[model samples]
Target: MKAMVYRGPYKVRVEEKDMPAIEHPNDAIVKVQRAAICGSDLHLYHGMMPGTRVGMTFGHEFIGVVEQVGPSVQNLKPGDRVMVPFNVYCGSCYFCARGLYSNCHNVNPNATAVGGIYGYSHTCGGYDGGQAEFVRVPFADVGPSIIPDGIDDDDALLMTDALATGYFGAQLGDIVEGDTVAVFGAGPVGLFAAKSAWLMGAGRVIVIDHLEYRLEKARSFAHAETVNFAEHDDVVVHMKKTTDYLGADVAIDAVGAEADGNFLQHVTGAKLKLQGGSPVALNWAIDSVRKGGTISVMGAYGPIFSAVKFGDAVNKGLTLRMNQCPVKRQWPRLFEHIRNGYLKPSDIITHRIPLEHIAEGYHIFSAKLDNCIKPVIVPNAG
Candidate 1:
């Protein structure tokens, strides 16, 4: 098997590796068909994620066919095409019972957090990821979802992470009919956030980003109104104007590190004197949200701390929800949506390359060049 092995910061190699085999009674071995790079993967690539040591397989979003399954896996079998959930969770945990699969204690028992992510790091359970020709999926009966007929691998790949995250974000933000929702960032998660907002009945969906190409794609595919953050020095003003000066009912932070700390500062009315360039969209979303509005943050974060405006958040009485998506809970609903054609998440796919050229795709996507929005890697391409 060949895989994109992470060597160190800003380095990856397409090298031969041993094929994975089923290790547990609940395990299944998937032949990787299509996998995509995620923004979170980039965080690891740039060494922003702590404890991500070298030589780990690096991918979390993918769809594949089940080449083999354990005897205990009754729901799924050989030849079943499935989408892999990024998080590895056992379905019987306390948190999983409460529909909080992301916080399942059974997966990441030793860590401060509860979730375990593939290809993330040793801290996230050190599970080998789906970036190779074959991946061993634990908890196969509970985790993998068989793709319905007529769905291609490219379209089903997002069910693993981005699309589900976006759906979870929108659901957490309480997007409803006649509500106005503002999504920060136009990256893959942000794009899906906008689409989820629209699908959940948001009357107006505004997507903010620096890239014109992404914003344009958001407008066309997500049915979102666009705000080019680079064009407007006062993003808050633009957001306010768009939302009738009352602020949006719900603001989702899909740009995590890019917007997290700044949003905290803005909502609390603190001084914006931070030296580093945090994603301004966070501040804009906080300032652009109405009093008592909801904010859902699904972006990845680092250990570095930034000042937040606790006072303003208190005064405004806003509700802040933050976490990784509980993919196990959301996967069923998302899959149904995809199967029914109500969600076309694959519209975000901007590039498709063979697994051999995955490094090149990474280069283009990491640099944000050539209108590259989301790139998929086909492992079996010959």
Candidate 2:
């Protein structure tokens, strides 16, 4: 099997690796058909994630065909086409019982805060991801769901992470019918969050980003207003003025870890690795929302210190709710949205690359070249 193996920072290449086999009774071996390189994958690519070791695969958003399944995997079988959520968990765990699948206590011996994630790193659980011809899926009965007959594979793939997280962000916002929603970052999650806000009855939606292409996508794909923070002297002020000076009713930080804006924060957090992740976007979210409003954070950050405006959030009585999304929890409603043509997750896809060319795919996405918004990997490209 050929897999994308992490070398060092800023380095990755396709290499032949041994095919994975079922290792647990609830395990399944999936032949990856479609997989995506998520925005959060860049954090691991750039060495922003702790314990992202060399030779480890790095992909989480994938839909595949089951090649084999263990005896205990009753819900899935050979030849089933499935979309596996990023979270790997046991169905009966305490956290899983409460539908907190992302924080399942039975997986990831190395951490207590998060459940096992496919190919994220040792920090979550050292489970290999599906960026290859085949991947090993644990707890297969609980996490992998068959892709419904009418759903597109690409749509199912995005549902594994980006779209689901975005919907979760909007749900956390608790948006009132006429509330104005401000979303920071025009990445996939941000774009989806902006789009989902409208579904939740938001009166207005604004997407913030430094890139013109992404903001353009937000306008067309998400049907939201756009703001380029690079053009504004202060984005927080711009958000406030746009919302009639009281600030937006809700603000969401979808850009995590590698946010740019403050020179020192990016340097210390992203470059020097001194802080967990740059809090520029998050701080901007805190400052951009109205008092007593809600702020939803779906961005990925390291498990360390960040210079967020904790005191200010308290002063303003803001409700901050965030977690690694419980993806399967959002599936039922998301499926209905997709089926009704209210949302098309595949609309955000900009590039599709063969597994052999994934290193180039990562480079183009990281450099923001070719108007790249979302890139998918074809493991068995013809």
Candidate 3:
């Protein structure tokens, strides 16, 4: 097997590795067909997240065929094509029973918060991820579902993380009909959230980003207004002005650790590792939104303290909702939306690289070169 192993910051290579085998009674080994490099993976690539050990594979958005399943895995068989959610959890746990699969208590002994996430880091559970020819899925019955008849593999791959998380972010917004929704960041999650806001009856959807290419995607794919924060003197004031001075009814933060617009924050958080993650995006969400509006954060941040505007959020009476996104929970509506031609999740996929070229893919995506939006890894490609 060949897997993308993390050597150090900005260093990764596809190296020959031992094939995974079923390690638990409820485990299953999947032969990966399609996998995606998520925005969150950049955190590990840049060495921002703690406990990301060298030699660990970093990928969570993946879909594949089951190679083998343990005796206890009754929901799936060896030949089933499955779209595994990023979460690795036991379905019967207290959190899982409440549809909070991302916070399952039975997995990730290191976490008192988020549950097991494949390939994230030791902090989220040190399980190797699917950025390879194969991966081992624990609690297989609870996490993966068979790819539906009409769904494309690329679409299935995005559903595992980006699409699901973005949809969950919109759901958290609790958007009333005709409300104004402003999304921070124009990455996959932000794009999807902007698109989903329309489905949730938002009268106006605005996507904020520094990149014109992504803002263009927001206009075409999301049918929303675009805000290039780099062109503004103060993005918060610009957002307020754009929303008629009262501010947007809802604001969602989709840019996690490596947000731009603030050099000091980025240097301190993403570069110097002084804080968990740069709080620039979240602060923008707080400052740009209306006083009583909702702020939904779908961005991936470390499990450590961040320099956020908690006092301002309290003062404004904002409803801030966020989570790792119970991916499976969002699948039902998302599937319906995809089937009805309301969304083509793979529309955002700008690059597809072979497993061996994952390092180059990482470089292209990390550098934001070549208009790269999303990149998929084909592990079994010829």
Candidate 4:
């Protein structure tokens, strides 16, 4: 098997690796059909996530066919085509029973925060991801679901993480009919968040980003207004101006660790590693939303201190909701949305690369070259 192994910051390569096998009674070995490089993977690629060991593969969004399954796994068979959610969890746990699959207590040793995530890092349970020919899926009955008859493989792959997380972010917003929503960042997650806001009955949607290409996607794919924050003296002020000076009814921060706006914050958080992650986006969300409005955070941040505006949030009576997305929890509505032609997750996929060219794929995505919005890895591509 050939897998993308992380060597160091900004360094990865395709290397031959041993194939995975059923390690637990509930485990299933999957031959990966499609996998995606998520923006969160860039945190591990840039060595921002602690405990991201060298030689570990980094990927979480994937769809595959089961090659083998342990005896205890009864929900699926060897030949089932499935879309595995990014979460690795036991379904019977307290959190899982409550639909908080991302915080399942029985999976990760550090489950006090996030549950097992495929190919994230040792901090997230050290599970190998599906950026290769094959991957090991634990708790097979709970996570992976059969790909529906009409769902495209690329759509299924995005549903595993980006698409699901984006919808979850919108759900957290609790948008009322005719409310105005502003989304920070214009990546895949951001674009989906903006699009989902419309489905939730938001009267107005604004996507903020520094790149014009992504803003263009926001306008076309999301059919929302765009704000190039680089062109604004103060983005939060701009949000207020557009919202009639009261601020948006809701704000979603989809830019996680590497948010660029404040020089000092990015330097201390992203470059110097002094803090968990840059709090610029979250702060912008807080400032851009109305005093009593909601703010949803779908961005991936490390488990450490971030200088967020907690005091201001308290003062403004804002509802702050955030968590690693419970991917499977969002699938039912997502499937319906796709079937109704209301959503197409694959529309954001900009590049597809062979497994062997994964290093180049990483470079292109990390550099944001070629108008890259989303990149998929075809492990079995010829």
**Each candidate's lDDT (Cα)?**
0.81, 0.92, 0.92, 0.92
Q: Which number leads on lDDT?
A: 2
Model 3, global lDDT: 0.92
Worst 10 residues of 4 by lDDT: 261-270
TM-score per candidate: 0.91, 0.98, 0.98, 0.98
Residue lDDT tens for model 4, 303-379: 54656899999999999999999999999999999999999999999999999999999999999999999999999
Candidate that beats the other on lDDT, 1 or 2, i.e. the better one: 2
Candidate 2 worst ten-residue window by lDDT: 261-270
- With a 3 Å backbone cut-off (N, CA, C), the pairs that clash in candidate 2 are none
lDDT of 3 by residue, 1-382 (tens): 9999999999999999999988889999999999999999999998889888999998999999999999899999988999999998899989999999999999999979999999999999999999999999999988999999999898999999999999999999999999999999999999999999999999999999998999999999999999898899999999988888999999999998777636666666667777656778999999999989999987998743656899999999999999999999999999999999999999999999999999999999999999999999999863
Write down the lDDT that model 4 would get. Answer: 0.92
Question: What's model 3's TM-score?
Answer: 0.98
Clash pairs, candidate 1, are: 258-279, 264-309, 268-312
- After superposition on all C-alphas, the RMSD of every candidate to the true structure, in Å, is 4.2, 1.1, 1.2, 1.2
CA lDDT of 235 in candidate 4? 88
Candidate 2 C-alpha lDDT tens digits along 173-209: 9998989999999999999999999999999999999
